[model samples]
Target: MSDTLTPPMQSADCWTRREIWQQPQTLNETQRLLRDNQGEIERFLRPLMEKTNLRIVLTGAGTSAFIGECLAPWLSRETGRRVEAVATTDIVSAPDLYCEGDTPTLLVSFGRSGNSPESIAAADIAAAKISDLHHLVITCNPDGALARDPGTHSHVVVLPKATHDHGFAMTSSFSAMMLAALSILSGVAALETRIDAICQAVSDILHNADTAMADLAQRNFSRVVYLGSGVFEGLARESALKLLELTDGGIVTAFDTPMGFRHGPKTFVTTETLVMVYVSNDPYTARYDRDLIAELRADNIAAGIVTLSAKAEADDTIAVRNLGGACDADLLFPYIVPAQLFALHASLARGMTPDTPNATGTVNRVVQGVHIHPLNP
Candidate 1:
C-alpha cells in the first residue's frame, strides 16, 4: 500500500482513490455551478431570510449530517441567524426535538444521493410540522426524491454528476455538498479564488503527503483519535467515520473537540493509539488546540501524534499552505483532504477493499433496513 500511494486506474479500489484525487477539480466545478445559479439561489433564500423569528436547520444522514455540523456554526456567524445541525435520522425519528411548528424555518437538506429514506423523510416531516417551512435541497442526484419531489416552497441545487460517488463511501459528494452550502449561505467574496487556493493546497498534500499518511496507516496502532475545534470538530467526526468505514471497523476510532477530549475521553489514549489534531487557524481556538497537543506530548500516551495546521512548526505537523489567511470556514475543505487519503490508504493497508469494505453486506452506500413510519395526522 505504501509502495502504491496512488492506486492503479484499474485497481479494485480505484474508485475511492480516484474520487479522492478528483475532489480538488470537482470542488472547482461545484463553485462554478453555484456561481452560475447564485441569483436563483439568492432569490429563493431572500424571502426565507426576511421572515421574522426565523430558524435554519441543516439536516442530513451520516456523512451528510456531518456537513451540517461543519457549516452550522460558520453559517450562523455569517448570516447572523439561528442555525442548527440535526441529522435526518434524528429528525425522522423525533421531529419535535429539532423542528417547531410556528417558527419560519429554513430546512437545508444535504444529501449525496438524495434517495436516502431519512433524507426524504426529514424534508417531508419538516414541511408537515413547520407551518412556514422552506427547503433548500443540496444534493448530487437530480433524480433523488428530495430534488424531484414537487413540494411547495422548495429549491434544489443539484451538483455535477461526478459527485454521485460510485464507491461505497462518499468522497467528492460530501465535499461538493459542503462547498455548495458554504457558497450559498456565507457569501464568501471571491469564493472561486479561495477554492483555487484550497485545491492547490490539497493537491500538494495529495502528492507530497500520501506516502507519509500511508506509512502512518501501516503502523500497528489499533485505535485512532481525531481532535479539532468548532468546524474541525465536525471534520474530526467525519475523519473518524471515514477510517472506521474504510477499515470495516477493524480499527477503533473516536472524535471530540480539543476541550471536550480532556473530560474522560482522554483516557482512550494509550500506547497503541494514534492521535491526529486539526489545529485551528483562529488564534483563540488554536490556544486550546495547542494546549491539548502540549498536554498529549507530556503524557506521551499515544503511539504517535500528528498535527495539521496552516501554521505548523514541527516535522510531525502537516502544513496546509496558500489559504491566503482564509477563515476557519474556508479552511475546512483543505483540512479534511488528508483524512480522506489516510482512510483510503488504511483500507488498502489492512488488505480490505476500499471500494466496498463492508464485505458482509450489513451496511450500504445508501443505508438499508430503515422502515420510515408515517407521521401521525
Candidate 2:
C-alpha cells in the first residue's frame, strides 16, 4: 500500500474521513439545528394534533422508516395516542392494510429528499382514502417535490442544510429529523429542558467516535451483527443498514432483536464476525441483552464484540458507557450516534465513500423508478 497519510479525495461539498474526525463541530451543528427549530416544528404539528380521533402515522422508507420505529413506543406514551411507524413502501403497496378505518390521520413523512416515489405516493394514498388526512413532512431538501407537493394538505418542516448529509447513508439528517418529530409528537412541555443534556450526550459520543472507529476499522471482519431490544432494535437496524450501504455490500451485515437472535440466527455468527449489542437501561431488557452477549462469548463465534450500555459497569469484553436518564424512549437518540460513526468509518477503512458507496447505483439518497399507480375505484 502507498504510504500516503491522507484520506481519499472527496467532493468539495462532501465531508471527508478526516472531517468525520471533527465530530464536535458536526454534532454541535446537529444540536443547534434541532434546538433552534424546535418551536417551528411544534407549531407545525399543533393543528394536526388538535383534530379528534387523531391517528399519527410515521411513514418513510429504509432508515427514514426506522426513525419512526425507534420513536413509536415513546411517542405513544408521551402523546397518549396511537402512533405507528409504517414503511411508505408498505403503504404504497398495500394502503388499506396500514391506513386503518376512516379516522382523522396525521401522516408524518420522514425523508431526506422528501421526493422518494413511495413516500409521495403513500401521502397521496392517505389523502385519497382518508377524508381527514393531514400531513407533516419532515425533510432536509426544501426543493424536493414532497416539500412542494401542492396536493398535500400538509406542513413541510425542512431541517437545516447541514442536516442534509453528503454521504450515501443518512447521518446527522436522520437524528435531526427524528429530534424534530420527538419535539412535536413527544407531548413534552418544552424541548429546552432536554436540550442541554442531549447536547452534552452527543458531544461525549463525538469525542469518542474517532477512537471507536479506529478500533472497529482495524477488526476487518467478514460480517457484523448488531443486537438491540425495544426501541434500540430499530436503531440496530439502521446501524446495520448504514454499514451495509456505506461498504457497498462489501461486508455482510445483520441486525436482530436480542431475544430473536437466539433462535437460529445466531448461526450466522462466525469467528470472523463482529457483534455490537445495545443493552437497554431498563433492568429486564438489560438481562436479555446480557444473556445474548454471554452466549456469544461462550460460543466464541465472534471475531470481536462491542456493547453499548447505559452504565459503564458491563460484564462484557467491550463496553461503551452512556449513563443518562430513563426518561421515556427518548434515550435512543444520543445512544445511536456512536454506531452511525462506527459504520461510516468502517466504510472508509474499506476505501469506500460513505457519501455515495453504491457503486452499482441500485440504492440512492433518494430512491427512484417507482411509478405511483392510482388506487382503483
Candidate 3:
C-alpha cells in the first residue's frame, strides 16, 4: 500500500486487498482526470447528445458490465435520454437483437483492461450494425484494445493507471470505472463539489468496516445474498460477483432488488446464509429497502444481515460518513467498500490468495478461451 495509498493491515503482498483499499485514491484520481479532460470530452459528446434521439448503451463483461447496470436507470433519468445496460457478451452473441442499425446510438464501453474478446467483438458488432453511432471507451488500461483503437467515431477516456488492477478480481478497477462513467455521462462539473465527500466517505468505510467485515468472513458463511433498489440493484449484482469471484466460488452468491427478492428468491437463504443490502439513499426507494431488511430480520432465517447505508437513521448500518445528502448514484462508491473488503477477507480466510483467488485457470485476469465466432453475414 505504497504510492500515496493507505497502508494495508493485511499482507503487503496481496494486491487484491491493497486494490480494495486503494479505491478512495483511485476514485479521486479518476475525478481529477475527468476534470482535466472535460473540455475534450464535451467536444466529443455534445454533438451526439444534440441529436435528441441518441441512445446510450453501456457495455462490458462481468464486473465491467455491471457498471452499466448500476448506472443505466439513473443515467437515463439524469440525461433525459434512453440509457440501457447491455453486456458485451450479449452483444457479441446476439448482435442483431441488442444492436440497433437505425437509431443514433452512443456505445459506452467500460473495461478495466479493455482487452476482453467480447468487449472487442461487441464494439465491432455495434460499429458494423449501427449506422449512426459513436463510441465512448472508459477504460483503465491506456494500452488496452478499447483504448488503443477506439475506432474513427470514438473517444476513449483512460483512467489513472492505479485503477488497472493487476489482481485477478477487480476491486479498485470496478469502482473507478463506474465512478468515471457516472461523472462523464452525467457531467464532470456536477461531481466536482461532491468528489471530496465521496472520497472521504470511502476512506472512512475502508478503516471503519475493515475489522467487522473480516470478522464476518471468519464465520465462513456458505452463501451470501445482496439486495438493493434502483441504481443499487446493479451494484448489488456487482457486489455478489465480487464475493463469488474473490472466494473462487467457495461461497455461492446471489443479488436482487429488495422487492424482487420475495418472488421465490428469498427461499435461497438458510441458517448459513448472510444477507447484505445496499440501502438506497432515495427517500421513497429507501422505504422498500428498509422494509425488506426488516422482513428478513423478522424471518430470522439467515445467519446474519447487514445493511450498508449512508444514512445514520438505520440502526447498525455500516454507515458511510459525510454523504447522507448525496444522491443514490453518489452513494454507490462508498457503499461498495465494505463488500469489497469482505470479499478480500473471505478469500484470505479460505486460505486462498486474494490476488489470484482462482485455483483453476478457467478464468483469466482478462478472460480467456473465448472464440469470437464470426457474425453471420
Q: TM-score: which candidate is best? A: 3
| Sequence-dependent TM-score of model 3 | 0.97
Clashing pairs in 3: none
List lDDT for all candidates, in order.
0.86, 0.74, 0.90
Question: Can you give the lDDT of residue 88 in candidate 1?
Answer: 92
Stretches off by above 4 angstroms in model 1 are 1-13, 188-190
**Model 2 RMSD, rounded to 1 decimal:** 4.8
lDDT of 3 by residue, 1-377 (tens): 22255745545358887788888788899999999999999999999888888899999999999999999999999999999999999999889899989999999999999999999999999999999989999999999999999897999999999899999988889999998889988999998888888888888888899999989999999999999899999989999999998889999999999999999999989999999998887888888988998899899899999998877664755988778788999999888888888998898899888778888878789998999988787
Colliding residue pairs in candidate 2: 167-355, 168-355
Error of 1 at 139 (Å): 0.7
Tens digits of lDDT, candidate 1, 1-377: 12113433544447888888877778878888888888888889877777657899998999999999999998898788999999999999988887799989889998888889898888888888989988889999988888899289889999988888988888889998999998888763457657777767767777767778889988968999999999999999999999999999999999999999999999999999999999888888989999999999999788999888887766546888776377888788878888898898889888888989998999999888899999877
Q: How are the candidates ranked when ordered by TM-score, highest leading? A: 3, 1, 2
TM-score list, all predictions: 0.95, 0.88, 0.97
Put the candidates in lDDT order, highest first: 3, 1, 2
